[model samples]
Target: MDIPRSFTIRESTHRIHNPLDDAKLAVLGRALRPAPGWSVLDLACGSGEMLCTWARDHGTTGTGVDLSATFLASARARAAELGVADRVEFVHADASGHVADEPVDVAACVGATWIGDGVPGTVELLRRSLRPGGLLLIGHPFWRLDPPDQAAVEGSHATGRDDFLPLPDLLAQFGALGCDVVEMVLADQDSWDRYVAAQWLNTRRWLDENPEDELAPVLRAELTDAPVRYARYQREYLGWGVFALMDR
Candidate 1:
């Protein structure tokens, strides 16, 4: 079985499969207030950077699940490098249907809410893996200001049939799921630039090393103009954030 190419390639090259920034991660870790030895689940965990970092910094145990074998391998290597192999484990499996074997103190679906339909459904699914009153943190995009065009809509991860909710709608969904939005941190324009620009550089580096690879053309196309696209649409129109929710 293979995960989507875009995600797998990005994971192998960038160590992050999703479009989250460091500022967002820090905000999430803080919002969850992850205590030492807490059990955590990271769904669609990419290369498991956030999970490994949290395990190391907070003395927690984490189990991360993803569909990408490449990402799972990378996660394993990262765990070993961080000397947290014993504290964290990664599984190569379908994230959308996977569940923790046991309840956890924290459950997260950062940048992968689509796994459970959307933010609301994903929130409910993640909560099933959390103990009563436990935390569920999610990373999602919002609009700094409402978009005015098709390019803006595409850049924001919003399109027809995929209704991306604004921040207030997100909070309401949290409420519907019987959770309270306790904390949130927004990704500013600089952070947005960092996230997008980093992708271009990483893609270019990969292309440079593998000039004959099948993906070289795709990488070239992206490298040629990703920065411009980001500056015009994504960085300009979208606001991304990591939000922490708890039992109301």
Candidate 2:
């Protein structure tokens, strides 16, 4: 009922699980302008940041589902800290096929589209919990520039170049799925650094504290290699964004 220990350790300090910074998330909140008291359903909502913050800032109520017990604990704490404990709920469950008991004003699956296999399947899954005319928020990656070869692709954490489409093709994908791209907030190289670089520090700190832990060697290796990998490939070739979509 939990994510891998390696993943939890690597992201222990992250409030948002994706390549989005708090400012970009705030910008997205303002752009969406979800009405006060609207309901939201967030799938694979790591740390429940979106639900907790939206409940605090927009007067929205919501439920967030994720399999990470560690992240769910953080999410519940954040809800209480934000004074939105009653407005949002965090569930420890598989998000892949989970649908809200009631339809919601906004449904999102940010950065975990693999829960539904891929973009098309994930989009359909999100729609199952959305009310008529409700918004869908999808967080996905695109190719800022085509990778030159397999090394670049692997360094960017993708198995193949086809794992991400170029920016134009990504937007076109939404249209093909019968959705209109309403609003989007993109991550620049700095945002990528903020997200990926922080993991190195988290890993190093864990390794320092628990030198004999079973995962220490793995973390040490990652800490040593991740910076070079990210700077060379991901920073240049991978672009990520959360796009607001509506039925066309």
Candidate 3:
């Protein structure tokens, strides 16, 4: 199985699918402090950036699983490019129920918690592959400010107000799941701009090159409205971060 073509088309140029830039991603790898030879499992590992980069920088080994064949190909190439092909592997598989064959030092489900239904379920899923006291990394979005109404929620790309919790409540969720929040790196408005604004350019470029393609209209519409929607709604209301948690 594979992700929708439209989804990949929109993010074809993204190395890291979330709001994290390269510097912030490096900061996260350092904060986690995974020793050389430590093992990691990254579920829904888009483009395999986290695994490949950590394999390069920290000398860690890992497996990345995703449903997107296109992304998996990019991930594999990234591993080779970083000279970590021997240390990391990318599998084109559904991450929802894919646990590591053996316990790992770090288990992560970044920015795709829906694979396990929601935060609690996703944490539980990650824990299944984590060694005792091992770290679990969850990337998620929280409400930066409470939305004014339903329209604001939709504008932020959420179906409803309940789709996401406030930042404090999100941290509390880790506690509720019996995990201690150990470290976190948040994305500011600039990071959000980098992530969302770049998609518009990618879409626009693709639309220009493939104007006759059936998806061109969709891309054109998205390019036309995404920037304003992101600037007005998502940038103001949504904050995203990757949180490191340890079992309590």
lDDT of 1 by residue, 101-120 (tens): 88999898888888998887
Query: How accurate locally is residue 86 in candidate 2, as Cα lDDT from 0 to 100?
Result: 97
Scanning candidate 3 in windows of ten residues, the lowest lDDT window is 222-231
Candidate 3 CA-lDDT value: 0.93
Tens-place lDDT per residue, model 3, 1-248, is 99889889889999999998888999999998999999999999999999999999999999999999999999999998999999999888999999899999999998999999999999999999999989999999999999998877998989999999999999998998998999999999888888888788888888889999999987788788887888788999989999999999
Flag regions of model 3 displaced more than 4 Å: none
* Candidate 2 ranges with C-alpha deviation above 4 Å: none
Task: List TM-score per model, in order.
Answer: 0.90, 0.99, 0.98
Mind sharing the TM-score for model 2? 0.99
Please state the error at residue 243 of candidate 2 in Å. Answer: 0.8
For model 2, how does the per-residue alpha-carbon lDDT over 1-248 read when each residue is reduced to its tens digit? 88899999989999999999999999999999989999999999989998998888999999999999999999999999999999999889999899999999999999999998999999999999999999999999999998999999998899999999998899999999999999999999988889988898899889999999999988888888898888899999999999999997
Judged by whole-model lDDT over C-alpha atoms, candidate 1 comes out at 0.78
Candidate 2: Cα lDDT at 219: 84
Q: What lDDT would each prediction earn against the true structure?
A: 0.78, 0.93, 0.93
Clash pairs, candidate 1, are: none
Model 2, total clashes: 0
